[model samples]
Target: MTTIEVKCRFEAKLLRPAKPGNDKSWAFVVLPRDASEQLPRRGRTTVEGTLNGHPFQATLEPDGQLSHWLQVSRELLEAAGSVVGDIVTLELTPVKKEPEPDIPADFKEALAAAPEAHKVWNNTTTLARLDWIHWITSAKQLKTRAKRIDDACDMLASGKKKVCCFDPSGYYSKAFRAPEAENS
Candidate 1:
């Protein structure tokens, strides 16, 4: 196994608030040692490092949770090294792994008929799928629910994974129209 070591200094300004949904204690940002290829590609690599003093490991995701943010342990860093502010430097190295296979076409075909929507949906991450399923299943009317499925499929085929009702510019588009508001 190939391993590289780096020395990092930690600063207080480099720390970010905990994620809204998790009990993470600290977060930091670190540039990948190798930038020739994006991190998280199949068989690409795993990054392991110590921030301040806390040890952490991170894997690359095609649609990464921490696209630009890196989570770390504040207490760990303070315990391992002296953190004066928000900046910290540490040694990091990448471990390679095999890539995952592409999604199956049959799975994609199971989506709604809107080709555009299907395309977008197929490209979205699993978390997006869970969110969409929850949203669609919560609808009260069968017709409304069907319409949501159609809209979702169309959006996916159109190369959009989210924001079904709006264009890339964030304007309302005729492509996706939600059901009219019910009379109060």
Candidate 2:
């Protein structure tokens, strides 16, 4: 079989804005609109790329706008010898197959208890599973989270293939967003 190479390249500032100078010292780079447009989809996109000459893979999250952003971990920064406020070079290509996401322990047990829901989940696409996980984990309150898990099981058992009323891009609901820049 032949392979098709569809790639996009751009330069962006590597910003270390999330919980700086600690165990959670995180960084990220945003893809400009023109470059983001070349991507396969506007929703959360997974890609394998090189960051400042170091190879890496990440899921690029939509910024609620037309663009996308990446969350670069501290370990990634150190591996590439990159720092915040530096112009980082990147090349990305969309992954044809998404990797499986880890299921939360509570959700795992919930699924196991509900055979129909578990079967539906097992048959759903990886991306849909990711959205379900995202919807479940995005809840900020404990009670809300438990309710979501219960609702997810019910929905799945009812033959709902995807999470209902979830805005993965977070554009309208403002539920999903990149880490705010320290200077912003």
Candidate 3:
């Protein structure tokens, strides 16, 4: 219900992006690379925009390939009277400020168990915390995720300010990527 200062406007075709376990994923639109360049950062950015006249506020995720993508919820699609495969108009702009990402419970617990890591986490900026969370959750497997959590705690305890060696834009290292579309 916030008034977004409209910036970049464009149209894109909706597609169903894949989820690891859930076959039925939300319709999503990948922002044009140029449009993404207009945003604040190549990392995770918060945006508010109208999709086919339906209002929405969401954290725009990096598309791994250097652009950005917004997951269109079914409710938003229905409200817009559109669906996957339809090209939709979008009046997009980055939010004035970034929101903190909610920490996963397990990660929160691990931080709590490590006083030094917890202290560092509390002292870090929201963006750094977000990157740490992203690096941990980007793991496609449960084992890798657990290992990342432990490593994160150790790194933080040792005074690391941010996640090192993580390619947030997925432009390099190829460790992160936007979910593949069903038809991709």
Candidate 4:
């Protein structure tokens, strides 16, 4: 029942933004390095928190070579009536439930169409499924995402239970580390 509360500014820096004439960009609120260490895990932790009085559940993810961050979707900002650079108050408690990835509709349909793959998917653990979903959704392009769905169905049907050569941890894959966490 350890509840971690923090009051901090909303960091609005764009994360891995697309180049000129590119797709949409991502943004997040950087968790203070000290506060990040208080969490149970690095990435994909379910958090119950309030931002500017708006309660929400957020997936705390690692920033590349930096501290953990809460993805500040436009919806969230609007709901909280917050904008970039606004100071925010957060009261967070890590929930015990396993996180479920936001599976794209196309991917779900693809799996449903492939019974064998769907069976495999159903039998996989939540974290394993999350990895597959992450790998697919991580694709920056529409075509690439579609390709991943096709590849995933084929691979799963062939009895592959996990994503090939995929690292679920942000460490080796993305080298995400906070200055304080670097030594931890």
Candidate 1 contains a number of clashing pairs equal to 36
**Per-prediction RMSD in angstroms?**
12.1, 2.4, 2.2, 6.5
List the pairs of residues colliding in candidate 2.
none
Tens digits of per-residue lDDT for model 2 on 1-184? 1213778999999876645555557788878989888887777888888888898888898887767899888888889898888898998888877778899999999999999999999999999999999899989998999999999999999999999899887878888666677774
Q: Model 4 over residues 157-176: C-alpha lDDT tens digits?
A: 99989998765446667834
Reference-based TM-score of each model: 0.35, 0.90, 0.91, 0.67
For candidate 3, lDDT tens digit of each residue in 43-128?
78888888888888888888877899888887888899998899999988788766888999999999999999999999999989
List the candidate 1 regions with Cα displacement exceeding 4 Å: 1-13, 22-24, 30-45, 53-55, 60-68, 82-84, 98-184
List candidate 3 segments past 4 Å from native.
Answer: 1-6, 18-25
Give candidate 4 regions above 4 Å deviation.
1-27, 52-54, 73-83, 175-184
Supply the global lDDT for candidate 3: 0.86
CA error at residue 80 for candidate 3, angstroms: 1.4
Ranking by lDDT: 2, 3, 4, 1
lDDT of candidate 2 at residue 30, scale 0 to 100: 76
Q: How far is candidate 3 from the true structure (C-alpha RMSD, Å)?
A: 2.2
TM-score of 4: 0.67
Taken over the whole model, the C-alpha lDDT of each candidate is: 0.45, 0.86, 0.86, 0.68
Model 1 lDDT, residue 10, Cα? 33
The per-prediction tally of clashing pairs is 36, 0, 0, 2
Query: Roughly what TM-score does model 1 have, to 2 decimal places?
Result: 0.35
